[model samples]
Target: MTDHALVLFSGGQDSATCLAWALDRFPHVETLGFDYGQRHRVELEVRAAFRERLARENPAWAARLGPDHLLTLDALREVSDTALTRETEITMQANGLPSTFVPGRNLLFVTFAAALAYRRGLRHLVAGMCETDYSGYPDCRDDTLKALQVAINLGMDRRFVLHTPLMWRDKKATWALAARLGGAALVEAIRVETHSCYLGDRTTLHAWGFGCGTCPACELRQRGWEAWAADPGKDETHD
Candidate 1:
């Protein structure tokens, strides 16, 4: 594996923290984002500013940060009719999955990211897909990612390692990761800049971040914040 890496940054709390992790480990780190016509497309709008802030505030990360690539996969919306792509209410489906779960979203994301990384000569691909604190998307599971990694390497004939820093950690621990990565500055950036609302609601801002505060994403973030606030040291033992 080379020292270069590509992070599948979604301008969300998890992905931003993963970006920090990438920057800390990889001397050359780039970012890749997909625009699948999500309801919360505002998340895409915040990426540049957050990257700018990180580069401006942290010289070390700035030195390692590379170009960011945003690819529009509008076809994903044409195929996926989830709440994340439409104005439907966020609810649990009869299949035991959340309505916001976009089928094959992360799968496609990693595949595309792998393609880009192959062209860029990046040997490592980092993402924030987590089964621990997520919308119960099967594609986010560690097993799925591991299997996909093998397929990607076989199909592309290149060894690309997939790194999921938040796979085992819950949302509270994700917050702790940000704090540990870049201290209060990274945490504040994630709290203020990242967007994770399934409703696309950015009109209101909460301590955890901006969202409808009632959607599953917002609720999970809120709960994580509350838990982390109560005991910030709880994640100190996490690997």
Candidate 2:
């Protein structure tokens, strides 16, 4: 019964992978991005450049996915600073949470995404919210998502299926998923183009991807890439 899908894209490796997944499953796909004023605002630019690259190189896919939709919510400014929203040095929580864990981020994102999907007649909303590979964002948990989805659907009086392609994937597995979706070319794009750095530092490079490699996000990504490369099956998903 589902046809149209809206991807809550953030121009990161995970969201990019989700976008590819949505493209694979849906005949009609569109992207939704957020500009909620994170310090890594460069990701917005990265998303734009990615679309431009797609438009230039893969016009067919570009036409299929349509233009990237961005929502600029300044309410994050009202939210207190942690690290991602400020110029302060990034710190990690005792439970692996980093200052980058913008509270209610995924919750608000999915809720807004659901509302947008309802308005656009989209029955499926796809996002890359991985509890398997993350820095302790409580809202990324599957239970939270399920609850939020039901609440949003009830609030909107519409049935929207939220798809999380990377919920169980680690970084290495994530790379493998990307490779499967579009082969090495997609993997290469993620490595060279996507921005996942908390500090918004894309100048520095690493084996996994670009970022302040010392940050928690980078550390997890680096380890995941190593595990994936060392994987015997290589394409095997996490256990």
Candidate 3:
């Protein structure tokens, strides 16, 4: 197997940053995205453009960047009735998690990613799942992913390292990470090319990105952008 990595790029701010992180670390890195019939499927639209711009940001990254893959997991819609999969309102469940939590989304994502990695001879899997500043998706927890890594390795009988660079990072720190990876150019690319709205609204453009500015994703992004813009120096500890 090769020492290449496969990043679960969702065309969101965090995933874009993680992609850059992978390119910086790995000699060869590929990207994988899912089309699970999400309401914000618009995020998929910007993936190609973001990757193009990201490659141009650095010569080494362009050379290290490899093939891109997209998977159509329409089964998620059949199994998930969350706001992200349907037109329902975003709300907190009685269990205290957001309605946007797709039951096994991240689990399925990594599982499939592992399967793909097996065939592609890629040894590392990277994703942008975070619990620090997010809708309380249980699947995004560190414990969940750690356990999943063990399960995948056992079931597949292959050693694979799952990397979650943004696991402990908040949005402001995530923005800082983008700036660190590709400077103001990368930050602007994320601001303009990434999509994180749950409502799939792309008409209005905010300083952070394009979204309704009221959804949990937009609010979190906007808050982080404002915080970072006010004082990026406060992100020293983020590294």
TM-score of each: 0.97, 0.92, 0.97
lDDT of 3 by residue, 149-191 (tens): 9999999999999999989988989888878878889899999
Which sections of candidate 1 miss by over 4 Å? 237-239
Q: Score each candidate by Cα lDDT.
A: 0.91, 0.80, 0.91
Clashing pairs in 3: none
lDDT of 1 at 196: 87
Candidate achieving the largest TM-score: 1
- What is the number of backbone collisions in each predicted candidate, taken in the order shown? 0, 0, 0
Query: In model 2, where do residues sit more than 4 Å from their true spots?
Result: 54-60, 93-96, 232-234
True-structure lDDT of candidate 1: 0.91
lDDT per residue (tens digit) for residues 118-142 in model 1: 8999999999988887877899999
Better of 1 and 2 by TM-score: 1
- Between which residue pairs do clashes occur in model 2? none
